[model samples]
Target: MEIDYASHFSALAHPQRLSVLRMLLRRYPDAVPAGEVAQALNVKSNTLSAYLAALRAAGFVTQERDGTSLRYAASPAGLSALFDGFLRECCQGRPDLCRGIGGDLQTKKGTDMPFRVLFLCTGNSARSIFAECLLRAIGGDRFEVHSAGTRPASQLNPLAVRMLAEKGHETDGLRAKHMSEYQNDAKAGFDFVFTVCDRAANEECPAWPGQPISGHWSTPDPVAVHGTEAERMLAFQTAYGMLQNRISAFVSLPLETLDNLALQHAVDDIARKD
Candidate 1:
């Protein structure tokens, strides 16, 4: 269904509406009840009801009567329109520019030439590990991704391993690796080196042979939390959720248009969640 773009955006302009949309995005294809969404976000039922009504009227959500209540789910066409609009506007009218940054959302077959990416952090534990597993799972066959730490850890953080498993990704072969493992190694230099730690981002990095484009994510260390096991796990989940969100945006980038600096700037803008 064709939707009024203005109405759709207007409905999303409010903070609550956007938050609700994000909550739905996190549960795509799963129709969540109005009460459940309200409770999860701590919004008053009536206030959230109004937001949902606006969203439904704007075609951002679809509502179905499920027994005693209604369930709201994402309208893919609506979301595509919204994000596609974003891609066009922010990318300066060039959708292909997304490929230059690292997007491999769903690479075409026979076009699986692997791009090299290195995920870095201070301890090679949580954030970097999440990036590696996430990229491998979602980056199509277009990437050969590795995660390493500026200061290597003797073992992988167990929480990171557990979280990855919970996310339906295999953690069998994952281990904490040293940044030195690939730095200056003729065979494995990266095409993109993303530092997930403040320390790693500021520190002098090993000279990448290809002079990989670099960026900093600066995620807080989840393993450093002094808390009960449940609290620490919650912290890890929070970090994982944040990383997952950023990675989804990063993977939407167009890596093929870097030769055009104008397009590169636009891609960069979209890649940074800040």
Candidate 2:
């Protein structure tokens, strides 16, 4: 099929249209309801519909009837064709520009551009916060990690902050934040997003940009354990240990070699560790 390169570019030219594409890519294989998409981007229903229509007309998006509402997803074939065509035309005479296009794009960019990761939970007071700090320490400059809650606590859990500090991780900059801060902003693209609590894992999430690989690591909420100070601290310690092990495993993965599906499976497998 002859790809309409100009139409695809034009469709992607608008900021809102590009935001729609990014959201669609984040939910790539899964079709998201139009209403959900609109809510995530904070775009008005009428405006969102117009943007989606343009994407659909450009062959960049595909829609399927899901009961009464339509669900939309990025067209992988169309996107692949569009990008390949763009690169080919741009590099037609510049062989040097095409030399390092294959393999993992992450590695190709090297560690100068850190991989962005976000951890999510219901409260943002414990598990998610711990994972964020742990991964940041382990991955260092290789990762830019952040954590948030669906319904965030007013502040970081005292136990969590102390536990991380005792272990020599910086807790100064860590604070509980709402997940909504990351949503609706197209520029806040994440490379990977993990939900550390069961509740947040099950809840509907905003569409993230960059098609971030996502997984659930169900760690027990330490705050729920009400006991003596020592016992409560032990619970926090246990949660910390679990996250440390998982983050260790995560950092050791050959991310530069694995494809997206393989990388996703690797991430899911980490959750199975005790």
Candidate 3:
């Protein structure tokens, strides 16, 4: 089959269009509602429709009708074709370079070293806890993830723990701790420090030892939501989904290639989407 790499590249040229593709990739094999995608990207419905249409035309994403609204997911075949075509063109007649292409691509640059990440919030019970757990579940081998709060909770939130358990995430070693613990410890440092709530982002934080790149991913406090048992559970689930989406985007980044300034911009861009 003939492939038009130019069209595919053109389709992905727009930043918003690329973001839509990444969002779909995160939920690959599972279609997400168009409205949800738009909400996550903070794009106008009309604008997002246009972006999706471009992706569909390029064969990067597939859309299916689920009752009234459309659902979208990444097309594995299209992605494979795009990548394979690039490699074939770039590595032609270079057997040695092509031999370890797959292995080298996955572990390229600084991926060998464990990246330490810290999630911070006003209270470590909910948002930060969920971020810590989700990142560990997704990128534990590559990242040493931790969470802390300015004012630590006495214990982990039961709802948070239950959500993690339901999602098949480990909760055995998880507990609330004060940010001061990491701050005062000379050896404690992080590659990235993320503030998951507005309160924490506004508050003055300790000067991290390594001067790690920092960004704010503001999420509503699920614990603060007052509602019925079902409603409360729903709140927790919503928060979990938000963090999962953000972390999925985080894990997908080509961290080894992006410098600190570029990495900081990328982190800030991810937060702006939500």
Q: Highest TM-score: give the candidate number.
A: 2
Number of the predicted model whose lDDT against the real structure is largest? 2
Q: On lDDT, who's better, 2 or 3?
A: 2
60 Cα displacement, candidate 3 (Å) = 39
Q: What stretches of model 3 exceed 4 Å from their correct place?
A: 1-111
- Alpha carbon lDDT at 34, candidate 3: 85
Task: Give one clash count per candidate, in the order shown.
Answer: 12, 0, 0
Instruction: Tell how far residue 259 is off in model 3, in angstroms.
Output: 0.5
Cα RMSD of predicted structure 3: 10.9
* lDDT per residue (tens digit) for residues 151-186 in model 1: 888998887898789889988888888887887677
Q: Candidate 1 at residue 146, lDDT? A: 92
All candidates in order of TM-score, best leading: 2, 3, 1
Give one digit per residue, the lDDT tens place, for model 2 in 1-274.
6677777899999988988887675454556788888777788999999999999998889989988999897785777677777777755846665553333534424456778888999899989988988998898888888899999999988888888888888877788899988876566487788888756754656678666778777788899999899999999999989999999999999776677767876886787787
- The alpha-carbon deviation from the true structure for residue 41 of candidate 1, after best TM-score superposition, in angstroms, is 41
Q: After superposition, how far is residue 11 of candidate 2 from its true place, in Å?
A: 34
For each candidate, give its TM-score against the true structure.
0.57, 0.61, 0.60
Model 3, 60-109: lDDT tens per residue? 99999999889997785787677677667855736655442222222336
